[model samples]
Target: MPQPSSARLHEFRIVSNDKIAQDIFSLVIEAPQLAKTIKPGQFMNFEVPGNAMSLLRIPLSFARADADAGTVEIWYAVVGDGTERLSRMKPGDTSTVLGPGGKGWGVPAECSRALLVGGGIGVPPLVPLAAELARAGIPFDVCLGAKTASELVGESELDALGAQTLSVATDDGTEGHCGFVTDLAAELLQQGGYDYVATCGPGVMMQKVAEAALAAGAYCEASLERMMSCGFGACSTCNVETTEGMKGACMCGPVFDASKVVVW
Candidate 1:
């Protein structure tokens, strides 16, 4: 398991904030220290201004980090009050963030090839992971899912990163396959070349990916999502049930061995 990194408050200035897809927004923030230190699959807690009653910060995983440029990009959906407020922030907006939190993907050095599965908003974290795999010269295939074509994110980005193959699925047949991405994943796993698998998405999606990876005898890791009330382990709201017992998502994970996870 990868150890959690210490969290700290960093002041950030929004470089750009734009709507990229239906209900999805892309936010780029300039925070040099954080940009240099945050790892793929780890999350950050953003303190969005404008809400006094909503004291808890918004915990989000980054899509990409440009260390040299001193910027970090995040993709988020406006599903709630906090996110709605977040989407309204304009460029040059400033805020404080607590981050470099939680353990990230632990792909072994021996991994020759990888399969990445992501759905909807969960696709953000996997973008950086794909880049890492590509940097290491480990070929990877991607399976993406969304409700419709307009809502899909990261396919083009992942393809640009040199993914071996990119497959997409939509619930409504507005895009590639007209079923769950799990179906695509299962088909790919059946061919038997992947040595490692990583997924982030809806609980059911990750659960199915975990099952398929296990069947294929591939080492798999998943970025689990939970309501992280605190970006640290102080609040027990993000506990995850595993074979070993309970663990906090904010510290012990946002990523974990898929086989050991007992609850999605």
Candidate 2:
């Protein structure tokens, strides 16, 4: 786990901010030091301008980090006031950010095969993990889910990263399998070659993925989303109930051993 001291506040400038899907935006920022240090599942808290009254920064996970280009790419859904403000920021807008927060994925040394499951906006963090797996010569598969075809993101990017098999499920039957992504995940887990599984999504979706991974005898890690009022551990707003006890997401995790988590 990364300590509060390891996470630094850096000045960042928006390189590009574009609407990629319905109510979803892809934001690229120039944060050279952050781009170089951020890990696959680590998150950043951005100080969006124009919200003078709102004190909380928007916490987001990056989809990609290009160290050579000194850029970090984030994919986020415009769900609230902060994000709505973030969506409006033009290129060249400048702000400050706190990152690389918390621990990232802990892929086992013997992991030869892996499975990644994501749903809705939760897909962003998994994208970089897929790239890491590919670079390590680990063949993996992906299962993605969205409410509708227009809401889905990251399939193309994951495919580009060489996922052995990419499957999708949409609630409305507007895309791939007409059901929960858990259906695809369960089927894949049953095939039995994966040694590790990583998932991020709605609580219910991640819980299901965790169950399936456990039954398949694979080690599973999940990135949990919580209300992080403070980017650091001071606020205690992002506490997650684990078997060990309650731990703050901003410091102890956004990622945790699936089996150790008590509450979804």
Candidate 3:
């Protein structure tokens, strides 16, 4: 009941197949139909063509959605089997992509100023959200964490969208900031004046942002990365424990109010 039982596998094209870093890729998917409703934190379930070896689907986040162009983007890193196969694809090659699925960027319009934090592959999805914020005349800041300078994915796009692109690395002499992205996020939250915070990245990074937002009395929402078997709610692997109980990340979230999630 979380989403339609099934949707057609619309067209999929790979805009960029080059590795941003050692294991990262900027894979952009073009799904025209789904673009209209695609939101900030939402994700899509994709079926890379010529693959009968894996499970039913692979879920990817809604990195960016352009309705005018009739396409949705997924800036993903080659993680495992599914992603690695996807990374090898080129433009005009089709994929059985079915979505705009999952809980979307829970960016409330009531808040005018916010912070968007992403880690390596996590940076792409925030680009559309930043663009949305820009269209709304809302100001936002962005902090991205990568192991090194080469791993940073969407710097130019984020900058073009009007987000004050704050890039960080484990090494201090790299770019904008250094150390864990969580540290940069912590500083931004403590420095004050943000209405809310939105984060999508590694779970630990999102958790840190949530902690900072909670202590500061500002709302925080996160998009999580989980192993989802059935991109819809049929499989339970994507479920996470929350204050309200367990909710499936594929359905109830890819995005959730940090306050509702119970971190053990």
- Stretches > 4 Å off in candidate 1: 1-5
Model 1 per-residue lDDT tens digits across residues 138-161: 999999999999999998999999
User: Lowest summed-lDDT stretch of 10 residues in model 2?
Assistant: 1-10
List runs of model 2 lying over 4 Å from the truth. Answer: 1-5
| CA displacement after TM-score superposition, residue 15 of candidate 1 (Å) | 0.6
- Writing each residue's lDDT as its tens digit, candidate 3 over 88-164 gives 78877776777767777766768968898888677776877788788888888888888777677777777888885
Q: TM-scores, in order shown?
A: 0.98, 0.98, 0.90
Name model 3 segments beyond 4 Å from true.
1-8, 13-16, 165-167, 171-173
10 residues in a row with least lDDT, candidate 3: 1-10
Ranking by lDDT: 1, 2, 3
Full-model lDDT, candidate 2: 0.94
* Residue 117 C-alpha lDDT in model 2: 97
Alpha carbon lDDT of each predicted model = 0.95, 0.94, 0.76
Candidate 2 lDDT tens digits, 1-264 = 336546889999999999999999999999999999999999999998897799888899999999999999999999989999999999999999999998889999999899999999999999999999999999999999999999999999999999999999999999999999999999999989999999999999999999999999999999999999987888889999999889898888899999999999
